[model samples]
Target: MNLYWHRRDLRGTDNRGLARAVSVSEGPVAPVFVFDPTVLEHAAPVRVACLLEALEGLRAWYRERGSDLLVVRGEASDAIPRLAAEYEADAVVWADDYSGLARERDRAVTAALEDDGVACESVHDSIHHEPGSITPNEGAHYSVFSYFWKKWRDREKREPLEPPAADALADVAGDPLPSRSELGFDKPTATPQSVTQAAARERTTEFCSGPIYRYADNRDKPAVDGTSRLSVHLKWGTIGIRKVYAATQRAAERATTDDDRESVAAFQRQLAWREFYAHVLAFNPETVTENFSGYEHPIPWRNDPDELAAWKAGETGYPIVDAGMRQLQAEGWIHNRVRMLVASFLTKDLLIDWREGYDWFRRNLADHETANDVGGWQWAGSTGTDAQPYFRVFNPMKQGREYDPDADYIREYIPELEGVPADAIHDWHDLDPDRRAQLAPSYPAPIVDHGERREGAIAAFEQARGE
Candidate 1:
């Protein structure tokens, strides 16, 4: 029997690693998942909650097939080799994970398995294209996304693999899965929507059915449920990338109008972006901590504890920024546009280190993926490849008026402004102290002058660049 080491790919259906295990196994494949303390150390409450839920869903799937997912707790190096000997497995198989720490873990596991005389196989199951598969002619990966996107779009994608047959799985039973508390994690402050494969599949079908057609128009408008909320699923590996892309293709085929077709393409573009960051991270793992495009001089980020705390508490008095931050606290997710805006606000307006924002999001977001999280923070901080230029700081007021025009998205999260007029809400930063008090006395005034900060941010960037 071959032992299938389940990592992020929690789902049985459309899993490449499981299929590979079955293919090579002489008998039914044994499956195991190790909750290593090393990995859990980097995890937060929200992500741990989601992980437990995803594991439960996976366990249910295995139980239905007369097999059980092995839930073990130990260092993978020790646990995996021991399991291989216990199961008397000839080989171990797993899906590829793209992060420096993950890569380190894999190396340790591989060495231990080899010492036990067991072979190993790791497949590229998560993303459609492997890191080195899509890249520039010279560099290991493309620094600019557009150049990468064109090649990624044109590259032929692989078909989604079918789940292993029930007969192909080992009939060994596993102990009852542990709860979040059992794993020493507190209850998540903000919970994510159901993160099972069922939820993911249903969401994909519903999104591709009609919402995809209006995605381009409604994606920027946070009030509308325009974009597919598939990030958490993708992060947890509840759904496969091939399946996501296939859904978009079907959506495009159903489109009757040019605009509808374009909308589908727009959503697909986001998928490409996800992969683009993955490739970039694979080649440049240090970019996670260090700037991808570093300046000659270090960025003079302000060490203002009060300002940072206010931003974290959604009390910075920037209405739109506050709403986005509050939405993260409430739902464990924020709209994509709002994510950029809040990130820009933190890195520019407050001049705080991007690492602070990245760490906060890492702990709070249920869908936090290392590559995407770091890439986005650096992009907003103007320290990433193909990122927004340093000179173009986002205007929170203009952004609020344009994206949340009716203040619907803002009001949905920030209830203090629920009764305030849309105009007054958008102009909250500009409103005088007495006028603001009269409108929404509960809400605080703007913490900093955005106009002054924008100019200051630009000058700071120029100084760092030595220009």
Candidate 2:
């Protein structure tokens, strides 16, 4: 018998790891999922909530096929071996995870399985190409994304694998899943959307049907529901990467014009970006906490308790930045453009350390993937590969005016600005004290002067670079 261990890959459909387990098994394959405390040690309420939901969906999928996903809680090294012995499985297989902590746990689990004489394998099922597969002539991975995107775009991707046939699955019943409260987690503040295989397929079809054609044009406009809203699915692996890529390929074939084709390509480029960061994090795991690129001198970041508090509370007095933070609180998700904006507001404008932003995102974001979260925060702080240029500190006012032009997105999240005019909200910084008070007495004024802070942030980076 063979054991298929579930990690991030929750769905039964289009799962590479599960297919591999079925292919190698002489007898029926038994599926299992271990809630390793080592992994949960870093999880937040939002993440736990999504995990439980996905697990429930996966369990239902297995049960329908005359099998069950055995859900157990303990350190994987112990629980997996114990389950393997009990199930009498000779081999175990799972999908690979690239985070440093995940890798550490996998190493321990592999050693224990080996000691017990259980054959084990881990397949790269998350991203299209595994780490170190796409590389520059000199380095292990591309530091610049454009270079990586070129190769990733051209690579021949594998077709999505079918779910294991019912006869291939062992008819094993599993224990009841634990509730969030039983798992020692409070109900999440932000209510995330459903993360299930059905939901993933529905979203992909709905998005690729029409929205993708206008993606490049409307993606920057937060007011429009232009994005696929599939990040949570990808993060949880409710949908397979090949399934997503295949959907896009179908969308491309359905396109009627050059513009539509280019728009589809634009969205595909983002997929490439996701893999690029995974490759980077795989090679340099320390980049999760430290800067990917170093400077001659240390970056001089400020530490102001009140400012940090305001930023977290979504009261930063920057309409757009506050809107993004509040959106995160309300939804456990933020638009990609706003994510960069808020990160910039914290690191460059307030001059706080990027780690503060990273920590908060890791805790608050339901869709947070370690590689993407660290990459984004470091990029905003100008300490990552293809980091935002030091001289181009984001002007929150211009951003508000350009992206949220009518301030519709701002009003949707920040009710305090619901009555305020879009023009007044965008030009809040330029408005004098009396005008600001008259416009919105409840909402605070700009926390820091953007013009001054932008120059200060640039000077700090220049000093760090010894320029």
Candidate 3:
């Protein structure tokens, strides 16, 4: 018998690692999941809630297969090996996780299992390609995405494997799944759009059907349902990365227009970006806390408590930034463009440390991936590899007017801006005092002048870089 451990990969469908465990097992395979308290402490309330919901669905899936997802609560290093010994399993199989914490835990678990004479098998199922698989001639990973993208596109992707069917099963009764209260987290008021594999599959089909055709033109616009809201699903492994890639390929093959094909390719590039960040994280694990670029030393940061509080409360007085923050609070998600804008505003415009924004997002974003969040925050803050130039500051007002041209996105999240005219929404501060008062009386004034802050940020960057 073999033990199949579930981590982020929650689903039974197209799970290569799970398939591998069943294929190689001499008898029935015991599927197990452990909820580690240490890990839960780092997860946000919304993330924990979403994870539990997904696990509930996964448990049902396992039951339908005449087996159970043996649930446990403890450190995985201890829980997994103990379970292996209890079941007398010959091998423990699981998908490899690339996060810093996961890597450390895996090492400890592997060492413990080795001492017990149980073999451990791992499969790279979450990402299309294994992290660190693609690399430059001289380096272990690519810092620039363009270089990574070219190699990524040229490499053949693995076809998703079918889920394993176990004829026999472990006879042990599973522990009852824990609740949010039991996990020391409240059930968040806001959660993910869906938590089941069925929902993720339906979304993938629907997106590939038509939305992908127009993705290029509409993806950056925040007001419409233009982009695939699949990050959370991907993060939780409700759907496999290869399945999404295959769906995109099918969409491309069926495309009648060049634009459609281009859009499909564009969306696939985003998948590459996801892997790109993962690769960076795998090679430079220290980037999680240290700046990837190594140029953040002696940098000046305002770190104003009032400004940070305002930013967190979505009262920055910049409509776009406020709207994004409010959206994050309300839905536990935000648009990609708005994410960059908000990060830029915090790190550059507000002169705050990027780590502050990174930590906040880590605790707030329902779709949080350590690598992607770190990559994005560092990119926006100009402290990451191949990051944006530090001297370049994002003008939140211009971004608001540009991406959310009709101001619908702003109005959707910030009620105070609802009555403001579309023409005046992005420049509400520039309006006549009487009209500004009449339109958005409750809205606060700009927290910091963008023009002055932009110069200050540039000067600080110059000093940090010793210009």
- TM-score for candidate 3: 0.98
Q: Candidate 3, 140: how far from true, in Å?
A: 0.4
Per-model clash counts, in order, read 0, 0, 0
Least lDDT summed over 10 consecutive residues: which range in candidate 1?
173-182
Deviation in Å, model 3, residue 82 alpha carbon: 1.1
Expressed as tens digits, the lDDT of each residue in 103-219 for candidate 3 is 998898899999999999999998988977898998899999999999999999988777775465555567789888988887675656777898899999999999999999999
TM-score of each: 0.99, 0.99, 0.98
Error (Å) of candidate 2 at residue 457 is 0.7
Q: How much lDDT does candidate 2 score?
A: 0.93
Alpha-carbon deviation at 442 in model 2, angstroms:
1.3
**Where does candidate 3 stray beyond 4 Å?**
166-172
2 or 3, which is superior by TM-score? 2
Question: In candidate 2, what are the lDDT values of residues 305-355, reduced to their tens digit?
Answer: 889999999998899999999999999999999999999999989999999
Which scores greater on TM-score, model 1 or model 3? 1
Residues 49-84, candidate 1, lDDT per residue (tens digit)?
899899999999999999999989999999999999
Cα deviation in Å at residue 240, candidate 3?
Answer: 0.8
Task: Predict model 1's lDDT versus the native.
Answer: 0.93
